[model samples]
Target chain A: MTDWTIDSLVTALRTRRISAVEITDDCLARIDRLNPAMRTFITVDADGARRAAKERDSDLAAGRALGPLHGVPMAWKDLCAAPGLPTSCGTRTRDYFVSEMPCTAVARLVAEGAITLGKTNMTELALGPFGDNAHHGHVQNPWRSGHCSGGSSSGSGSAIAAGLALGALGSDTGGSIRLPAACCGIVGLKPTYGRVSRAGAMALSWSNDHLGPMTRTVRDAALMLGIMAGWDAADATTSRRPVPDYLQGIDRGIRGLRVGVPSNYYFDEVDAEVVTAVREAARQLGTLGARVSEVRVPDPVPLGEATGVISRAESVTIHERLLRERPQELQPVVRTRLEFGEHIAAHQYLQALRGRGRLTQEFLRAVFSQVDLLIAPTIPEPAPEIANVTTGGIDEIIKKMGRFSRLTRPFNGLGLPALSLPCGFSTRGLPLALSIVGRPFDEATVLRAGHAYEQAAGWVNRRPAIG
Target chain B: MNPSSTDPGVTAELTRLSDIIERLSRGLGLADEPASFVTVLEEGAPGDD
Candidate 1:
């Protein structure tokens, strides 16, 4: 069975064209077949999924009204806690640990009648951009074997691309969500930092972390975001601002919208194919009546560094007790990075924290003032071989990881909404993506431009030949 | 400090921290700026619209 975008699946399920049981069973069977090959899931709750799907069918037969996501089978990254299941967060330290606490993001989806297939795999502590995990193994690219899946949302990307689940919840600290989406050739959104509640998701970086959806289609992302976005007492950092109907605005079209194509920073030193594809995407958006033009981006190096500082410092704080106790249980790179974060002087960490507001102001004034949204490449290059990224020395590994995350990190620092939608494929068949970044709390516009470009390009639904 | 912090890559990140400090100290008003932290991640500013 092909992966059904939520919008399509909902209609089919509602009309009895496909039973929830049939869809769940199909996905579970695919997970069983693909999990060993690509390592997309750490666990598959087959019995639980069957039971849940049965309940959905029963509810429908009973003439009960259901939530928007009724009977939809979706996966959650291991970072999100689902009651009675382990939230491994892609490390041996917590591989067997199960949390009973409810994840606000997962609950929001489940409350809308979304059924959990299981937790998808990820990098250790949600670190690393290459989708590698010493404990979980790498989530290989679904398009082709042995290529990077673009992680720490590794398995979420692979699973969705491989059609193992309809869509999945992915968390982005630096570039986790969008990177995987780009690599797996799916759509991923890193909503503004406070746009989604992160109460029960594993916090890799307290300040930089964002929870968003990784889906097969842009409209699916809009539907999922509308379900999950809003304030929650569990996460005090959540915004009290009203969440917009993302689907309603998704098809608004980019007519007359000022779209910025970065003249610097984002395009610097990127792969030629990636640059070409995104430029072509921007050109297509222009054809759709978006007034796309080149705009100078403030030097992104400082912003990236600040984002790294905040992420590192917050990760260290989160793992302090673990590092002090069971450090050996962690992945060496994750452990090493956490160890390094300990040395960041309090004043230095505070500087990055306080500077964010002022820096975002500078960025918004210098760039966003001229454009309603900015379009850039989600990654510098297409996915590389898994061996090429994972076997390097710690220093070499860190450098490679930085390149993978560079374009996406600055947005995390700015706390802007960025959506990564597949623009085209590389010569090697790996996917490249265009990023649509909008103002804080303006995910609606971001998704709108993405949906518009996606329809014009007709690239997103061109499924990978994995299954 | 963990000895790993001495690695060149990690050292570079610390150095970037200093660069940010220097940048912020250059009349950017970092001192009076609240850490803004994660809670304030949504609103750009009251008048940002």
Candidate 2:
């Protein structure tokens, strides 16, 4: 039962080997036993989940079929608005906030026959990279309790790692999804900007934000992404392009693929252990008939600065009215950051936008010209202590957040797709991951390479012991 | 006038910008102390002069 991946679970259900209700019950039992220490969920709708499972069972019995994720129990980050669940965004201002209608992504998943377990925890206002929520308390890492679980999708990562949920939806602005996935030893995908809709999810940054899936394996992440991607009327930024069958290319081997490694900025000042692990992953790819070479990234610091400008400017705008009226409602860290956005000059914001297009074109011309994907350490180091995050001091908090997300923010600026997969574990028993980034709208290449590496490395088979 | 130019008009513009930020902080219930604030500018902002 503990060895069940989404593939194995779907096979079991299709063969009539086990009922959906039974699987739901097993998951609920695991949550009951493990959640006290993990604190992954702000709310768990077991009753609702059981009811959905029973209905799926009936459909199976009647031969009225649903989609691929039929009868699967999954969780979503609290930021996603569901009909009856609170979309708190990990802040006290909207702690009791619930929506009459579900977010477009959540509605689509339910329509595909996936059962919703409940909303998981997140960092306050989704601002900090460490998943410590002052309102709902901190979420512990499933692999090691005393350490941090990367945020603001902290609960999404921990829940899947502890088997509390089979899969989860997480929103990433600056490595929120990938960082947690790396820290929790799961597979997280940040699809190309505008590949997934951001209409109903809480907005942190209009330009850089992305919504995607986190799962225990690359194949499962691909399955969830296929269902989630598409154009939506509510979000104009969503591309009108057709959704590709992401799972279709999983078996495609990387025969002549070129993988580039950023030799300068990404490799500098990284933890020795994380650097060693990523180097080993590159070596393995080389042995598997793929060309691996070091590539230069000119001044990634400017890209990082541009990402900050856009994100902070948009965030301040989103909360402008709220900041004016209910100023005391936010956590100190979130409040200070939102206030800092006022300091961003209008011309500076516009200049950042100008630099963005030029930098993206430069990145594509230099790196993608020689390689199919770019590889780097997802995070420079393992999880830091939750207490290290300062409360009201915005500068201190931003520095801490930068440490966790610096490597991934530049890709967001370029509107490219990147996936994080566990490659090895740290000396302290935490996970270290490698990120595979692809060109715009080329999620297929990223997913294919991730799946192939996952098959060769066999890291997906290792599950954290929560009991 | 070049918006990027750092002239006396730009200094006046910075004063206005400071006023807006101060008002925003007051609205967000943040402390008005200078230590809590750090201005972020682009590489070639006129105000940096």
Candidate 3:
């Protein structure tokens, strides 16, 4: 049952080899068995999911047209409102919060016949990178217990890896989606900012936040993106950039495509094992007819720091009322991080915002001019142990957590499309990932390149042992 | 750098990062090109209908 990918489940349902109800039941059984150790779900809607599957079966029996994701079971990060489930955002402060309606993104997925199994757990307020939640017990990495499943989309990543769900929606303010994907040996896409609506999702950093899919396969990512990416009048930031048939060009192959390897910044402090795995991934792409070459990237320390300033300031603004009212409810680390944002000067936040545009355009011109995609390690190293991160001194904890996000956050500032897929495994058997980045609104090319590399590298077929 | 550091120390570190960011952006000559609100606008032509 853990072997069923999203595509296989879709094929089985559409071709009548399996009923939607049966698939949903199998998924529920798996969740029941694995979720105690994994703690990937905050809420499990067994009744609602069962009812939705029955309705889907009725529609299929009547020969009605099916949505692209008909009868596929999935989950949403607790950051987003799902109609019946509580939107916890992984904090005690939000324990009682539930929305009147599903977020625009989830609404679209439901309309397309995807069943919401439940809401996945996340970091408290999505502030930390290591899937650690003092409120909800830290999410255990299915690849190995005690090791981390990256955050703030912790459960979304853990669930997919443990075979509790086929695909899940994970939001990324800064590497929330990709970090977990890398750690869990899955595929995650942080679609270009504003490519999907965030009308009803919890706000972390409004400017940097992106909503995208985390799945086991690149094709599933493309499929989910097509269903969810488009203009939403509710979320004006969503691009008028027309959505493409992502799966249409996905298998087109990356023959002769230019792939850029950053000469600096990306690999500066990366682990030797991670560098070896990513470079080997690049070599595989080159062998598959893509020209892989090293290119200079602008010093990213400033850019990454700029993104941090903007995100923290914005996050504090969003949570100010809560902090002022119920400061005691937040986890200590999240509270301290939010309170620290109050010290960032208004002029400095403004300067960082202004620098963002200059840096984004400069990066586009410098890198994309030479390559169609940029290849780098998704995180500097493999996932560390959860206890190691949470039990450390505050400064050491911040450094350990920030290390995973260093390579990924700069892209959030630029708002480009980036995908993280498993490239190889470390000697300790932890998954390592390579990120594929492309020009804004060019997710098709990113997916195509990732799909091609995934096929060539062949790392995603191996599943983590959850039992 | 203790987990239990005083608020003054935390504030000082944040202030230093803020100073660094301000210095870094001071000469970029991007005063007129704000980045936050352009994504929803007409691609780069923000004022266009």
- Local accuracy by lDDT, each model: 0.86, 0.80, 0.86
Model 3 TM-score, 2 decimals: 0.95
lDDT of 3 by residue, B1-49 (tens): 1123466658567766867686767757835456554452234221232
What is the DockQ (computed on Cα atoms) for candidate 1?
0.44
lDDT of 3: 0.86
Candidate 3 TM-score on chain B = 0.43
Q: What is the TM-score of each candidate against the true structure?
A: 0.96, 0.89, 0.95
The per-residue C-alpha lDDT of model 2 at residue A13 equals 91
Sorting all predicted structures by lDDT, with the top scorer first, yields: 1, 3, 2
DockQ top scorer: 1
Best by TM-score: 1
Clashing pairs in 1: none
Candidates, DockQ: 0.44, 0.03, 0.26
- Cα lDDT tens digits, model 3, A41-60, are 98999999999999999999
| lDDT of candidate 2 at residue A286, scale 0 to 100 | 84
